[model samples]
Target: MELTNYLGLAAILFAIGSATVLLRRNSIVVFMGIELMLNATNLVLVTFARMHGDITGQLLAFFVMVVAAAEVVVGLAIIITIFRARRSASVDDVNLLQS
Candidate 1:
């Protein structure tokens, strides 16, 4: 398979992830969407790095993975906390504006 195939797949994944984030209301789904998007980005980065015969893109992907790990930790904690307080995972149900 050509390297372009990887890029195309990454684009499709990113689009789906974006749609999930935009169309879904469940906090967990949105978080998964975000993770999907991040993975797509990593795919693109790694593909480019392979095509270029350079380590830059792979290095960037590694950093991105580290950030993603941190995000998973923090994002899940927030989701759990919200679910506990609101008893619902819908984004609309979270009304922080209320006094």
Candidate 2:
């Protein structure tokens, strides 16, 4: 496949992820959407690494994966805490930070 094809797929995934984050009210679903976006970015990074014949992009993708994993850990912990507190995981119900 061509590089453009990979880029297009990445773009599509990113768009879907963005839409999910914007349109969903559930915190878990939003978290999944964020993960999807991160994966899409990884795809683009890998594609660029292959196109440029260098390991830098791949290394960056690896770091991104690590960060994403950490994000998942922390995000889930927060979500679980919120659920335990309120018995609900809806983003709309999380207004504690509001002034």
Candidate 3:
């Protein structure tokens, strides 16, 4: 196919990810949705890089991946800590803003 096809796919994936983030109450699921969104963004970047014949987009995509990896590490650790304390992974149960 074409770049448009890839872009469309990325859009759909992003929409699904957004929906998951909005609707899901589980912390792990929400994190998964965020990761999905990041992957969709990377897909778009790679597609644009291919269309433009430039390395910038690909480099950006790589950077995004690295950031996503770090986020996953930190995010999961926080989630695990919350789960250990609350015994539930529900996002609503997390109230870090509260003292």
Residue range 14-60, candidate 2, lDDT tens digits = 99999999999999999999999999999999999999999999999
Question: Best to worst by TM-score, what's the order?
Answer: 2, 1, 3
lDDT of 3 by residue, 1-99 (tens): 768999999999999999999999998999999999999999999999999999999999999999999999999999999889889999897778997
Clashes of 1: 0
Candidate 1 per-residue lDDT over residues 11-91, each given as its tens digit: 999999999999999999999999999999999999999999999999999999999999999999999998998799999
C-alpha lDDT score of every prediction, in listed order? 0.97, 0.96, 0.96
- Residue ranges of candidate 3 with Cα displaced over 4 Å: 95-99
TM-score, candidate number 3: 0.93
Worst 10 residues of 3 by lDDT: 90-99
Q: Sort the predicted structures by lDDT, highest score first.
A: 1, 2, 3
Clashing pairs in 1: none
Roughly what TM-score does model 1 have, to 2 decimal places?
0.94
What clash pairs does model 3 have? none
After best superposition, candidate 1 residue 35: deviation in angstroms? 0.3
| Candidate 2, superposed: residue stretches over 4 Å from native | 96-99
